[model samples]
Target: MPTYRTTAVDAVHNDEELRLNLDLLEGRRERAAIREAKAKLQMTKYYNARVRGVTFSPGDFVYRSNDASHDVAGGKLGPKWEGPYEVTEALGDGAYRLRSMDGTILPRT
Candidate 1:
């Protein structure tokens, strides 16, 4: 695959521009390094800025991410915030098994 270069993510502010200019001549290996750095910078930006939701632990109640909203109780029956799904297993990094509000064991939605 071709390398992905990111100007925005790898920016050196105007003051640092002169100092960073030499990295341009750093060749393919260093170019690759800068590419990786730019990717990591983008990932870090996403984690630091774009990610806004709060994290909950084992017993905490978290809303399920699915869009089929319905209300199951209070005599209302449409798609409601499915959980307060008790976080069960931490599958890999972002995936988890959630206990449905109705006590059904469903894959993390």
Candidate 2:
């Protein structure tokens, strides 16, 4: 049986034929990259269309996730949210400085 290598050797008769095949392969790769980029943009648009932007201003009360606070001791039954912490500063891109009820600023945002 003629394997892939033998078939390829039979298909390309000369260096010119090999160069033609390489050019076709390069065109195929460029087209594939364009298709991939279009697919990514389509997926991004579909996802962003469904996304709702929630912006928090300074002094707004927000709840922190227990998982964010690294409170692993609570296990299954513990409260999912840790805080009614006050947002002290809006640090752009949904990050904020939080202050506990007692007025101590959290070390991390």
Choose the strongest candidate by TM-score. Answer: 2
| TM-score of candidate 2 on Cα atoms, chains taken together | 0.79
Q: Write the per-residue lDDT of candidate 1 for residues 40-90, one digit (tens) a residue.
A: 999999899876765556665667743544335434445545556777666
Alpha-carbon error at 74 in model 1, in Å? Answer: 19
Candidate 2, 1-109: lDDT as tens digits: 9798866675446778888899899899999999999999999999999999999888899998887877556778878898789999998988999998999998883
Instruction: Please list the residue runs of candidate 2 whose C-alpha ends up more than 4 Å from where it truly belongs after superposition.
Output: 1-16
How many clashes in each candidate? Answer: 6, 0
Score each candidate by Cα lDDT. 0.64, 0.88
- Candidate 2 residue pairs in backbone clash: none
Q: What is the lDDT of residue 18 in candidate 2?
A: 83
- What's the TM-score of every candidate structure? 0.38, 0.79
Cα lDDT of candidate 1 equals 0.64
